[model samples]
Target: MSVSNEPTLKPERPFFSSGPTAKFPGWSLDKLKTESLGRSHRSKIGKARLKYAIDLSRELLGVPDDYLVGILPASDTGALECAMWTMLGPQPATVAAWESFGNVWIQDAVKQLKLKNLTALDADYGEIPDLASIPQDNDVVFTWNGTTSGARIPNTDWLESGRSGVTINDATSAIFAQEMDWPKLDATTYSWQKVMGSEAQHGMLILSPKAIERIESYDPDWPLPKLFRLKKGGKINQGIFEGATINTPSLLATEDYIAALEWAKSIGGRQAMFERANENARILEAWIEATPWISNMVSDPAKRTNTGVCMVFGGDWYESLSDEDKAGVPKKIVSMLEERGVGYDFNGYRDAPPSLRIWCGGTVDAEDVKRLLPWIEWAFEEVKASHAN
Candidate 1:
């Protein structure tokens, strides 16, 4: 059947960027707790707010009582770096990467920190590496979900229960949307901007007791940047995990995050977010299965991510294009969809092969995602028609 160039209905809320994603259903400026703003983060009220964010994050994510959650700088990248630069030296390490952000960690291990006893296993955009092949005896670093590639580890069973090494995960896009085996993750990092749909550029670091021990016991030979330092006088600095940050923080962003967390609580916390994300992705997955010209970037449904759902062109129209033309097809589709006001910022990562990545995180409504699918088909048909002439 020929798809209409114009979709009858557009997404009610056309805000689906993977990061800094769609806000909670009832979000507004007044929802933020503004009392903490315009005050020094070191003040009693400010520290209390920060501590509250930490505590609430723990409550919602179901982090263990022993685990320490801290607000860090530079979004997820900063949080992961603080964990890496502090704990990675003097241990045989394994880094598994399949997407854009994970590759950055591989570069840090090889070129920056220059770990001699490191094993780096990586795959193409939509594929995952052999998780079973990774030696659990060594320090393991990987992303829980590949936001750009839309591939995620199906479960944490592969991580050894009794392991000598620590497990560090960059779970930026997966934390609230997926089930996290917290006990298995010695060090995990995430940002509020992804699933929670809060403002961007802030990160949360969750550290297990084992991770703290690693910090206290081992010290890197090279001098750590001030922002990366998590220790003081050969002891793990407890204050950092408390409200006392190494640098000043944006209290406004913290307020925004707090509002999002409160909204999360009102809506039944982590499980609610997980269910919404699952339903949103399921809606898109159904559309992909029924549509002739569109297909998921990640083939295996179990391994595919429920948050950032990446898709690529398929069928005769896409297959017939030249290599250069095929590279631009997804971009054209995204641009046309945006022009029609049906979707925005749904383009795939620059480094990944041409595709579209829709944010199907909890903050996005299932109905909006369903509405966006027809618009995607309309955009594709419009692009194909233009190219033919």
Candidate 2:
């Protein structure tokens, strides 16, 4: 069946970028303006707000009680770096990297930290390494979901329950939206901007009791920047975990995050959020299954990510294009959708292969995602018609 160039239905809200994603369904500037602005973050009110964010984040994500959950400077990168610099040097490390963000961690471990006893397990995009192959005695670092590649570990069965080494996970796009195996994760980091759909620049770092012990016991030989320091005088800084952030934070962003957390609570918390994300992905999956012109980037259905649904064009139209033209097709399709005000930033990551990555996080409504699918088909047909001789 030929798709129409004119799609009657449009997404009710077209803000679908994977990062700095669509805010909570009823978000407004008023929700953010309630922040205690024009006051020091060190003040009682400011600290209380920060602490609220921390406490709410812990509650929403179901973090363990003994874990040290804190708001860190910068985004998810800062939180990962804070963990890496503080805890990685003492043990032989193994870094598993499949897509863009995970590769960055591997690079930092090998080139920047110049660790000698590091093993980097690399996989192609849309594929995952064998989690079972990682040594139990080695510190393991990996991304919980490869946002760009749209591949995620299906479960935590591969993780050793009584493992000796710590497992640090970069879960920026997976937290809240996905069920995490908290017991298997020693350190996990995420930005407020991804799953929660809050403003950027603030990261939530969740550390298990084991991770805290590593921080208090070991210090990196290389001098850590103030941003990466998690300890003071050979002890883990207890104050940072209690809302005393190492650097000044955006009060406005904090308020935005709190509003999001409240919205999350009103919607029944993590399980509800996870169901929303999965439902959104299911909408797109049904469309992909029926549509001959498109297919998911992930080869394994079980490994596919529910949040960032990356898809590539198929059939003769895509096959006829040269390598350079094929690389640009996804962009052309994105431009057509954007020109119609149907979608924004629907294009895949710059480093990933040509495809469209639709954000299917908790904040996105499944009906909106369903509405967007017909537009995608419409845009693809239009782009394909133009490219044909």
Give the lDDT of residue 281 in candidate 2: 92
Evaluate all candidate structures by whole-model CA lDDT and list the values in order.
0.90, 0.90
Question: Which runs of model 1 end up more than 4 angstroms from their true locations?
Answer: 1-5
lDDT string for model 2 (262-367, tens) is 9999999999999999999998888899999888999899999999989987898788889898988889878878888999998999999889999999999988
Candidate 1, which ten residues in sequence have the lowest lDDT sum? 1-10
User: Model 2 TM-score?
Assistant: 0.98
Q: Residue 11, candidate 2: how far off, in angstroms?
A: 0.9
Tens-digit lDDT string for candidate 1 (192-264): 8999998888898999999999999988887899988888898877888888988999998898899999988
Q: How well does each candidate superpose onto the true structure, as a TM-score?
A: 0.97, 0.98
